[model samples]
Target: MAVRISKILLVASIGALLLLIALDNVFDYNTNYEIVSHVMSMDEVPRDSVISWRSITNPTLHKLLYGFIIFTEFAAAALCLAGAGKLWRERRAEAVRFNAAKNIAVAGLALGLGLYLFGFLGVGGEWFQMWRSATYNMQQAAFRFIGSIGLVLLFVHQRDD
Candidate 1:
């Protein structure tokens, strides 16, 4: 197996991880949730309704979600670095190990976030929200796509070079 393919995959994975981190940095859920809640209440609640902190930020839930998103992003960052180093060192064989880990990680990210977006959050009915959802899904799918590439490279590495 050759390290060339792994090097390419490592670059792609790093790009994807950086993209995800950038996205997380740019978007703030406190604003998004409030906006959504406002929209949902538009057809029902009166214009005089009061907007409170509870409607904006659920402390406990946010705590849990904050930890989850941050940890996942952090793991992604670490994996990206590890993959890059493995590729730089031309560890085609060991890159296979990183790829396997990446495949699982991306699969989990896609499944978890996809479920949270469609099933739990129920986003996408209008233009802004739709764009946001698109960005979110695209970023997530990027991770999974890179993971698939990693897996393929791993299989390639498993072969005789």
Candidate 2:
């Protein structure tokens, strides 16, 4: 029962974190949007003759991509919150039932991990060379998100049985 409650707290905490992030992104739109814009545009990266084609300079496209990211963050948060609620409600159930209640939270964490690892690290970092930009680099932040969420994900995945 203690373990179940702890798991609920961890999952809910992640959900709250993601919700805050999405809220921050929306409320402080220009700040994070600028970061995303710079990463996508590769404006801060040193000109590499071979990699010039990877840059996306279109403002409309940048806005679209940023919107998509914000939407994803919201979705992950909602799913995680819902999952946490489910887990809490089922905390006193049998072990198998409690274990079964973890699916949504896992999906939420997986979405977050995917966003940080694949979206930021793979697409932004590798494809757009975001790491080369001292002003716009997001690799470190992305890694932190990935690592933290991943750890929570692993912990939540533990079987109550």
In order, what lDDT does every prediction score?
0.44, 0.91
| C-alpha TM-scores of all predictions | 0.39, 0.97
lDDT at 87 for candidate 2?
94
lDDT of 2 by residue, 8-66 (tens): 89888889999999999999999999998889888876676589788999999999999
Scored by lDDT, the top model is: 2
In angstroms, give how far residue 51 of model 1 lies from its true place.
25
Give candidate 2's whole-model lDDT: 0.91
Model 2: CA > 4 A from native? none
Alpha-carbon RMSD, candidate 1: 8.1
Instruction: Please give, for residues 1-161, the per-residue lDDT of candidate 1 as tens digits.
Output: 44555544654464475456536644765643443444332323333545221232345654554455455555555555555554445544554554554443344334434433443344322312322332232335444644554554454334333
Candidate 2 total steric clashes:
0
